[model samples]
Target: MTVQTTPAGTPMPDTMEPEDDDVKIIADIDEPWLPSILTIETGLPTMGVALGAGLLGVSVNSGRGPLVAFMIGLFSAVLVFLAVIDWKTYRLPDAIVLPLYPALGLAVAAGVAVGAITPTAALTAVISMTAVFVILWLIAFFTGGLGFGDVKLGGLLALVCGLESGYAAALGALILPMILGGLVALPLLFAGRRKHEFAFGPYMVAGALLILLLPNVLVPISRGSLFH
Candidate 1:
């Protein structure tokens, strides 16, 4: 048996294996992958995104009309891709997220031009994105539980939700992801899984998808006494 020494010069058993949770956390921190490799390996997820986008396009048209639905479908596809990448690597690459800002801007602009959303609505979307991003950043800074990637993803989801419904939808986007992630984690906790961390991106994406599909659930609140 080999002995290992800690940085503090304490001796430890090298035969001790890391816990499953520890292995996952270590991989999250240390694993790296090339973009090309990720693209090739994520075919199933990509196909899933495509199918989701198709269904979303149909749903959006039925609910909100065809003009805005296209953009929402497109955005949903992007979110799905981002969610998969974050789940696999625990990182959000700027190569994907950065270019998306301008693309989203264009999509919003197009929506306004087509009368799918008003200029006021577009401004609200921007405000929602900024607010959600700052709130998550503050949470991460204080609690050290979330990362910048999650913050950025939250901002993007808020933007989409706000555009689709209203500020209330944005609020739902902010709250729902954490609730969904917590629900998944609860079972593991009850089973005695300690110090485990899971990806928040997928839940965030799921929340955004839910908001898009069920905007009426939030739209009523957006116009209710609480918001008004």
Candidate 2:
């Protein structure tokens, strides 16, 4: 069996969880509305940034109407920032990620307010987020294919997707990201970098965005715009 090792040739951890820092700071500060923001990369890869911008455009053009579009467009911007940070650092800070749950919760509520999403769909979003978290946590426990950051992000994605579609679609979203990740992994394996750890967050983001934007992509094709 091929053993994966780091640059120093040490066996990779069973779970590729980021090593915790030892010199932890202790403080008594007000638990303000936010957690401490972790250090993130200011410089991002151009391709990833461009893709993010494209996704933002797609979100705006999703044809879900104004209020829904604004919410998702905001989310797309946030995802872009997270995706680039994760792509560079392989870390998604709790300060950034955890806020998204409540934000999406608010989005669902607003969507209901605007009659963009049904009350039943809002309930299903809750169910879908819970189900996605449990399933992702199990996968992390077993295969270590995902990090806690990815798990949280997956739940957020599930909530948004469930609000738009339904429970089954949200659950079905689990597969595409893995398939996408595997496809990316293949090149590294072939290039003899099989042991190299790459970020999984971008793939997860891409998968969710694809599902969310598919109707927009499909409608034009169906109407024979490209074919014509």
Candidate 3:
């Protein structure tokens, strides 16, 4: 038996190698134009989600009149945006979350200007924000369970909800988020899909929105007086 060699002069086994002409390399097709369009499309769902939340905030604050409703709606819009970004990226940009501090101040000032909130209420809000921030920061530092973004978001929620409602309301706001996050994470843990790390900002945002929308229900719970 005679052994054949390849055109490149390499020795060939009994099985012959496929010719270069028999092979075809397909280049990855690029659609540069589609990405910009897809990017826009991808963002629409997030915007719609945020807008729905804003409308809910408006409806919830309807009893307080249009101006307050509008303010809540605007704040809810920001919250929804933060929640979506954090869900997708697991990061809450300081640029987005930090401006909320001054925006919250302006919100308080607006409430004061319109006689919606008393000076004492504003003071309580500041204290509540500080307390929440410290507590969450400590949790993140010790356990590394929550991120800095969550801490900042918690403070923002405490300020906004506490100012509008009360300290009890702030407590309720914080509690609800933890509950929501835990509820979702528990199932994931049981199914072995996740290993402790999860996006918490969305739950925080949800809790804040819920508290903003239904202070009557959450505030009483926070006050520890269901009958009252």
Compare the candidates by lDDT and give the number of the best one: 3
For model 3, how does the per-residue alpha-carbon lDDT over 127-223 read when each residue is reduced to its tens digit? 8888889989999999988999899888988887876655554554578888889899889989988665688998998888878877667667766
lDDT of 2: 0.69
Scanning candidate 1 in windows of ten residues, the lowest lDDT window is: 20-29
> Candidate 3's C-alpha lDDT?
0.76
> Is candidate 1 or 3 superior in lDDT?
3
Residue-level lDDT tens digits of model 2 in 1-228 = 233555555664444543443222233433321222233334434445646655674565567666666666666667766776687668877888898888778878888898887898889878888888899999998988789889988888888767655533353347667888989898999999967988999888777776565644533443467565
Clash list (residue pairs), candidate 1: none
Better of 1 and 2 by TM-score: 1
The reply for model 1, stretches above 4 Å from the true place, is 1-42, 62-65, 189-194, 217-228
lDDT (CA) for every model shown? 0.72, 0.69, 0.76
